[model samples]
Target: EEDKIIEAEAQKLKEKFKEKSLTDKMKDLLIRSIYVEMLGHDGGFAHIHAINMTQKKNILSKRIGYLASTLFLDKDNELLILLVATLQRDLESESYLEVLSSLQAISRLANSQIMTATYDQVHKLLSHSSDFVRKKAVTVIHRFWQINPNGVVDIDRIMKTALCDKVPSVMAASLNYFIEVCRQKPETYKDLTSSFVVILKQIIEHKLPREYDYHRMPAPWIQMKLMEILALLGEEDEETSNQIYEVIQMTLKRAEDLAINIGHALVYQCIKTILAIYPNEALLENISKSIKAFFSSESNNLKYIGVTALNAMLKIDLKYAEDHQENVVECLECSDDTLKLKTLDLLY
Candidate 1:
């Protein structure tokens, strides 16, 4: 019955498209039909309309077309290769929005064939004039790398430049890409540690533009990302750990001064980073205080993170977590069953 309704809908859409021009209403209905087709209906009815929409001069039509194509076409679909030329043209469009839309589609729809065909165009956008375009380009390149790492030429240079991108959004996307690279081959990218450290210092000093600030905190997401990457790079490397120690201390102190919600999150990430790098006695004392402070919060989320961090701390040194026995017991009385379970684990 559902399939019958979908086929009826598709037939109505096909009749509507017979007119020389599309009204906005008709365009919307078409997009809806493509969406339904995407839901495993296998009607195979929307592909031609979707492709024609991509060739339309109207930006809205192009956007809907790209979106529909991304949703309805599988990576292995033969039709996907047909969009390579269209995507390349849009990637070079004078309008940044067009470029952004194409990049977004490629990011989602890219396969080995699509990545190889459009790799150069996407790479050029990494240095596009608009920060918005640059940010999206960085993300697309990351996706392409995942599909075919060798397709991205000079990645080391590309990443180094991206990490230092003056725009915070671009830098943030680059950090995400770098994180993936570092995770898989830490030694190859370990030398980039100082570069991340420099960025962290700049953020800590409030050098980022006011636009990146959240609740008066300077780029907390970036801060968190830097901490994450640092944690990854510094793990099991004593020299890297020592190099990052001062900034880690500064970050902890800075997070402590922010508003409660954001502060708790930063502190939680900091605790994880600390554990990864093997915190010293001083840092352990700070983590102990931070975890206990979390337990005092009325928010269950804070309590859960606190409990988890404490469990981790216990692994490093029983002495720091010993005083938190009362805090753990208090958590058992809370209404949150998940938090209770985590606390129970800690207690066990």
Candidate 2:
């Protein structure tokens, strides 16, 4: 009912924008109203409003540009070409802010044509002298690769250079990109095994600066990505398996002092890596103990992770399902829907 009312008002405001007598203040307010209620809105008036708002020389106008482009524009929209043109013009500017904003807007609203047209500029920004520009550039590349992997030219070279970057933010962004690419083409990164494992070990062992911390803890996202990549690379090779096993053991040991949610994610990914690569009785027992410890944690997140890990373990060996039956059954009484669902899965 409220959305319908907002839509009605938005329609009225659209008609008001057509009036030549409308003041700039009234126009701004109308844009804000439409911006707030952009959801479920499919009117063409927003395209003109966003374009007008974007042309104004102010921060508010720039923000409106971002919001409007993200909310109102899609690949098939006729207005996308205008948005792309504006972004390209901004990118060509010498101002860092302009380039950054353009980079951000493109990341959010880029279509195949936008990606293809702006590819070289973003690629050059990876090596930009400013860390801020480089970081944003790496992120844009990552987003672009995700949407169209083949759209990114020289990705192997890009990944290799990004991973070797001195900045933590740059490295993290590159790792994220690498994780995605490796998911689709795991064998393409086999050559980086030794270097990748070394970096993962350093990160897991807390050897990096605080910049790497996700939430005041070691970077769990990077750690989990590395574990996944390791699982792929080490699956059938005894030497690689040993290397990953040691890293997993260290990660589990470090989980004791970490934040509950972070610890749970780490343990969950660690268990998955172990199961994927080398699931010996000893490794399984180690994961079993980790999950049991998570169950004992006061944090529900940990408990959910525990249940999830146990559910996965049960698939590998039904004996685990039997061993942890009592504990798993207790989870059914929890109020958390996800935990309840996983517990029910375990029970059945």
Candidate 3:
């Protein structure tokens, strides 16, 4: 049956083209490989590219894309492919995107499966021109960091390179992705928060207002990402919460990090993030009296943030329940569902 099929294809090719140049031969090879891939033999794609009939048509890496995506569905296969792809120093930019996409798919694979990340390749792709391509690299790298729960991306090196990104989209993508992975594995990223720290520190040194020019905002993808990681970090660590508090303090006092409108919105969002992830006792014990110390003296923004965080504190065990009753009453009066349920249960 195989012999008959080959014969049939030979007959079709011969009759389809009696005269062909080198260019035609190359096109034929590409078309045949595409056909072969469609028939399920993806492993042969590289060799297929190597045998191109045209001298001018460089199809080697481009043809291999079809093969790499299949590796995305399986971890063992992915790691083997990653090793091979990473070893090839001349890989075109397209191959990097293929690799990044494959790794992105890995997040859906079995959680217990362990695989190696091509941190070198990921670092390279972060500099590419395409936003989508660069963004995929960010997601894959950040996810890997989450799995390792350690700062393997070389925080210092990343900080040095991050500011070099020609495009804010790329810079934001890299920083925000790092933050997300840290959020996922907070216990591992304490020192790795340098990017955010650096940005905040810069804001303080220049005495810049939180209000920056609205014309130069982080890309939408980056903004959402920072928000996500912020919420996650707040949910995971006391130190992170405190650090955010410090950044907030810096933002309030320095007022140099943002412009008036953007600063107002971002400050609210930042403190909200801090409250959401602050955990129940993360603040009340050491900072409890200190928290109440300035409760009534600040901006309405401060009051809102304090009350929200205060309500989170109100959910303690029965022994500590009575201490935050007024804050709980304040929380219950608001019309948010989650806030209402949390405070009403205590009141009843």
- Please tell me which predicted candidate would have the highest TM-score against the true structure: 1
Whole-model Cα lDDT of every candidate shown, in order: 0.83, 0.75, 0.47
lDDT of 3 by residue, 10-127 (tens): 4554444445453436455446545544555442433323322211224443333334333323444433343334323322435454444444544333122332434565557666
| Model 1 Cα shift for residue 63 (angstroms) | 1.5
The whole-model C-alpha lDDT of candidate 2 against the native structure comes to: 0.75
TM-score of each: 0.90, 0.86, 0.40
- Pairs that collide, model 1: none
- Candidate 2 lDDT for residue 154: 75
Residue 141 lDDT in candidate 2: 87
Tens-digit lDDT string for candidate 1 (94-208) = 9988998899888888898888888888888888899999889888888887887787878778777887788888889888887887788888877888988989999989999
Error of 2 at 183 (Å): 2.3
Model 1 TM-score, 2 decimals: 0.90
Off by over 4 Å in 3: 1-124, 127-132, 145-160, 163-166, 175-268, 272-308, 313-340, 346-348
Off by over 4 Å in 1: 1-20, 34-44
Task: Give the winner by lDDT.
Answer: 1
Instruction: Put the candidates in TM-score order, highest first.
Output: 1, 2, 3
